[model samples]
Target chain A: MFRSLLFVPGNNPSMLQNADIFMSDAIIFDLEDSVNLDEKDNARNLVETYLLTTKELPKAVVLRINPVNSDLVDDDLKLLQTRKIDYLLLPKANKISLFVLDKILKKIENKIELKPTKVICLIEETKSVIDIYELAKHERVEALMLGAEDLTSELEINRTTEGKELLYSRSRIIYAAISNKLIPIDTPFTDIDNQDGLIQDCKNALNLGMKAKTAIHPSQLETINEIFSPSQKAIKWAEAVLKKAKELNKGAFQFEGKMIDRPVLEKAKKIIEKAKLFELM
Target chain B: MWQAGSKESNDCLITLKKSDKTKIKIDSIVGHLFHNQILNAVKDTLKSDNINNVEVLVEDKGALDYTIRARLKVAIKRMMKDV
Candidate 1:
């Protein structure tokens, strides 16, 4: 349901309240890289108060806490326990093996003193993408986010308009996320003003199996939502597939001269769900 | 110059006239509106039991009015605990 997760900087107060007006399914109140080290405490304090006191937010509110090893992370975790945030977003989470992930879950539990059932919004940098399958297998992970900026920085490769550089990473993320039954969210398009670029990038990611995308600016939210949602054509195709499958009455059928089977039907159902999400009838 | 004035407990002043004086002055009405919302959100602390005076100044960067508001809210929320 969280097709668009917008990043509203934790230190920016007006952005937080304004975020509520959007139709995005999730809001990432960033307290990590978006915040300066000197402002971490201030950002954390504000985020806590906003969630507690502000007008009711519409979507799932998630706090991207500082890294686990950072001194700031302790206070971030402590503060989350007192807030209405739905997820404790963990960043720089590269190389998350089974044992390491379990350790993080345990630390979060101890720090926040929450149950093990509490899940993590896991963002994967380069090293983490290398071990994606193992990380996603952990029960504590709720969603897998591609941290392209960090990964690109780590790999020392420039990200192009086409996002061809991160294709492997994107594929790995989808594999892991699908295996874990978790949503795979793509990174934001850095060029805020390039609407056409954003649209194409979103389509590419959606085509590659990203269930949702993160938006850096509010202006980008509308387009991301539009590009990912099932279009009229997609809805028609899904409906046609369902109808064709029903007519066949067999497990396997044919559509557009291609084989349609149980898996195809499932995909069609997902498309239908997306259409519903878009209110496209 | 940025002015700080409080009319009510929940309302406070937060001004940010461009610190960089080299920049040209803006007369656009829309520009002011962008910073105004930011100032109101950050300085007001709407959830406070008390509502009072408010003022704020913002140095614009050709940003939309909404961006101004969002940034200001974070600043005010950060300072809320101390207030």
Candidate 2:
């Protein structure tokens, strides 16, 4: 359901304070990958203020903390115990056993003394691709973000402006996320100047049943959000399908003079679901 | 801190400067940033208390320590009260 998630470097207090103005569907305060090793602590402390002082933050707030294997993971979870942190975004998560996730979940629950419901896992490695279905099945997992940087590292493939190299991994992610009813967020398009590349990636994600994507810069958010959203034509088609289904008294039917089977029907339903996010339906 | 475990260091950076009724600078903070996780801890500390700010700056490494935030807030509050 997150139509756009922007990653602001965890160290930048200004970006954290003003993140709401951009109005992305979600904001990722990155403590991994983006931050220098020396500045991680300062970055984390700065985020705490942003989390506390702001009201009605324009979107869902997710903290992109370092991987569980990293040195700071324990302290990060400990601090989150009493604070009103949102998603626990674990990056570089590959081949995770339920034990690992459950352990982390327990730690968070004990600290904040709250039930564990929110978690976003980054699927960024080839090993993760094999275990994606199982990873998606984890009850606490609500969203799966495609982390191309690591994906490229694991696969030994380079990403191109056209995004052709990511096709297989992208497809597998969609299949896995959709099967588990979890939201799939696409990888960031690093070539910020290539407007055409971002648009193509968003279109591909949309075609594959993805609902959102990550952005490295604020400027990329607009194109990604717009492209991934339901088109007016799509919204109209969804309305027509539902109307026709109601009239025919059947779950399966035809639309646009073609058979609209379950898959097609579900696709149509998704259109409405996504459209509802923008209040179009 | 932003991550899970570490008792070795404070995860944040803290500074106290007299307003001197001078305009606050945006770019840098004078107090040194502790190694690695210190910056994150300071930033995370922001949630624990309120800040009135003379001026505060944080550079994230990989960890956000809570003490960093707490120190900054206490410093800011003290500065605000003195005014």
Candidate 3:
């Protein structure tokens, strides 16, 4: 249901205060890259305090903590011990890091008598791309995100708006996410000023099976949400497919030269659910 | 005391230095309209944290009261953590 996740710098108090007003499906309070090294503690304190004091936040609140090897992950997880955060965005995620994080989360959950927090793994490095299948198998993994900025930097390649270089990686991410029933989230379009470029990028991601996208600026949220929402034509097609499948009561059938089966029905159901959630119905 | 917070645009950067004389000095730069509102909130947070002797300088960029309070609280907490 998270079509657009808006990232607000954790250290920016003004932005953090007005975070809920943005029209994003979720708000990510970022404590990693966007924050300065000296201000990590400051950002953590600010985010923790806000979560503790705020009466009611409008959308789901996700906290993007520092990387696993940064020696700050423990403190970041500690904030979740008492707070009611929706998800944890683990940057530079890998199999071992996810395993270690899962253990830590379990221990914290047991100690504090709290529910387990869902996690979104950020695949940022080439090495992580290799182990995505293994990483996605973890029980707590709810989504897989492609961090193209870091991946391109790690691979020592120039990034292009066409995204030809990331095709393989995007496909691998989609495969891992889908095979494991996790949501696939695309990377942010870095150029904030170019709306046309953003739309094209979103279309590319949509074709590759990404259900949601990340937003570095609030301005991109509307476009991302709109692009990811199910269209009226799509909803009607899905509804027709479901009705035809139910009427036939067959395992597989032909309709308009396309095969309809359990998998197609499942996909159609998800589309209808998303359309309803988007109020397209 | 130790300095904390950022001076980024639209953020309140609070620099707190410990002082030997048991006195609290306040200085700030904010939008002309909410100057007093931010000032009172910062001073009240300092008192609540029992920060009696410190030099506080605030470089605010149109921040609200809660923001000012959050920044000052972090600065004070970092100072206390060091002590």
Candidate 4:
């Protein structure tokens, strides 16, 4: 149910204190790329302490830990064993990395009384894009996030504002995620100052069936949330369609000179459900 | 000598030095209101870790109890490594 997931550097006390205050649905306490090697231990300790002591938290608390192969992964998993984390965003995720992480999570679950943390697999490499369906089917994977910056670098192409280069990968990811009934999160728009660009980017992702989006800065949350939310017109149409169906009491009917069948009715029902979940109704 | 944390707002810089007896000094922006609480945070962390015979200097910028404890824990671990 995360329309917007904001990234917060794990070691910054100022940001950590206000993590839940932002309007974003979830906060990703980043312990990977945002943290330097020298400050890895400091970030881990800081995030752990924050989680343990903070009584009020955001709707969802996600931790983007170091890569699965890194030595820091062991310490990163320790948080799951002791603290309350909702999701683990695995960077540079692949089959081997997911296998290793699943095994580790299993071990932790056996030793503790805690529920297993959900996983969000970051799709950045070509191999990952190719194997996305399999990755999406993983029992622990709840979402699939497209990391455009890293994926572009791997492809040796400059990512343009038009995002033509990412169309194929984005489509594949969206399809796989939807087919598996998982949430597909779009990459963050890096240009913090360009509100117009952010709006267009969010629209493009939404049109392609992306359910959620990531935000590098808090400023982008408003636009992302607005674009991804079910529009007022759509909600009204859905409500009208449901009313007509109830009145007709028929499998197939005519509404506004268009054929309304079971599939269309189901789609209308889904829109109303989304509107209610997002508090738009 | 070992140190952890930073001088940023809502954070504290902790410095540790080997000594004959344990001593703690706190210099914080919110010292007037939370001086004893800050001292207890440091003492409780040290006691829980079974650390003694060290000098701790906390330069705090309104850090909370958990933050102070985290910084002190890292400082203790680094200091013990050299000992």
Ranking by TM-score: 4, 3, 2, 1
> Which residue pairs in model 3 clash with each other?
none
TM-score of chain A of 1: 0.88
Q: Docking category for candidate 4?
A: medium
lDDT per residue for candidate 2 within B29-75, as digits (tens), equals 32354443443444344444543333444433322333345435545
Residue-level lDDT for B11 in candidate 3: 70
lDDT of 3 by residue, A14-88 (tens): 778888899888998999999888888888878877787777684798999888777888888878954668899
Q: Tell me how candidate 4 scores on lDDT.
A: 0.92
DockQ-based class of model 1: incorrect
Over the true interface, candidate 4 deviates by an RMSD, in Å, of 0.7
TM-score of chain A of each: 0.88, 0.90, 0.92, 0.97
When summed lDDT is taken over every stretch of 10 residues in candidate 2 chain A, the lowest stretch is A92-101
* Model 2 docking grade: incorrect
Report the C-alpha lDDT of model 4 over A32-118, residue by residue, as the tens digit.
999999888888888898899898888899999899898999898888854579999999988988999999888988888668779
Clashes of each: 27, 51, 0, 0
Worst 10 residues of 1 chain A by lDDT: A93-102
Q: Provide C-alpha RMSD values for all models, in order.
A: 7.8, 8.7, 2.9, 1.4
Of the candidates shown, which would achieve the greatest TM-score relative to the real structure? 4
Q: Which portions of model 3 miss their true places by more than 4 Å?
A: A240-264, B7-9, B19-50, B55-59
Model 4 clash pairs are none
